[model samples]
Target: MKKAFFIVSVLFYVNSYSQSESKKAKILEMISLTGVDKIGVQMMDNIMNSFRNRDNSIPDDFWIEVKKEVNSEELINLYVPIYDKYYTEEDLENLVKFYKSPTGKKVTSIMPQMMNESMEIGKKWGQELAQKVIQKLENRK
Candidate 1:
């Protein structure tokens, strides 16, 4: 009976490990379909540009080497856990399916533009709110 229990436990562990690996692969596919991996690289580029702007003394070779060292895979791997925490394996599978569809492709393509425009609008709205608050404070004085 003890030997049978041990065998059962080993099978359960192997099955669970296999499922975990499958889930991780699905998570990677979902992330790639969403274009978040590309976005992560873009963000890294933006940060490097900002750094270059601040210090022009840095050599081009140094920046080139730095850029080469930046790995989007690491960023993508970080995202996997967050996604795994919030989404079930089934949810990831559904999302992967959607992202492969035409509408999902369109959404991924246009999302960056929409987000940029939204940020501009939000900035303007925030400035207006700030002015109003200042005006109200002045009136109180």
Candidate 2:
């Protein structure tokens, strides 16, 4: 609950500061600056596809388990620099624009909930497909 509220609060704050450019254009500029146009899309797509698994065999009590390993603030601090290196103001402006817009606002509002659903969907389908591929190879052998 607190996490979701914080995300929304930050999004709102960002949006309040940036609205001069269209979000799409800003996003495009970011892709260009990041030099990801060549195959970044494909790479990210592949990564997302790989996130799915059939058994949904994610760590049980995942949040609690993660909390046990390290403090959230410390973990966030570790990733901040890596993220900051890639995230330019233009990228942020675009994100803020999305966060402010009607569709973006709605998406952001449900972002966490949506991710949980997506993970389950991805895992269930992904595992099944992978299993079939393995079975096919075993049969051929």
lDDT of candidate 2 over 3-114, digit per residue (tens): 9999999998888556423433455543444333534444444544455343356654653454366443443344445545676656667665666678765765576678
Worst 10 residues of 2 by lDDT: 30-39
Candidate 1 collision pairs: none
In TM-score terms, which candidate is top? 1
User: Model-by-model lDDT, in order?
Assistant: 0.94, 0.59
Candidate 2 C-alpha error for residue 114, in Å: 2.3
Stretches off by above 4 angstroms in model 1 are none
lDDT of 1 by residue, 8-122 (tens): 9999999999989999999999988999889998999899999999999999999999989988899999999999899999999999999999999999999999999999999
TM-scores, one per candidate: 0.94, 0.42
lDDT of prediction 1: 0.94
As a TM-score, model 1 comes out at: 0.94
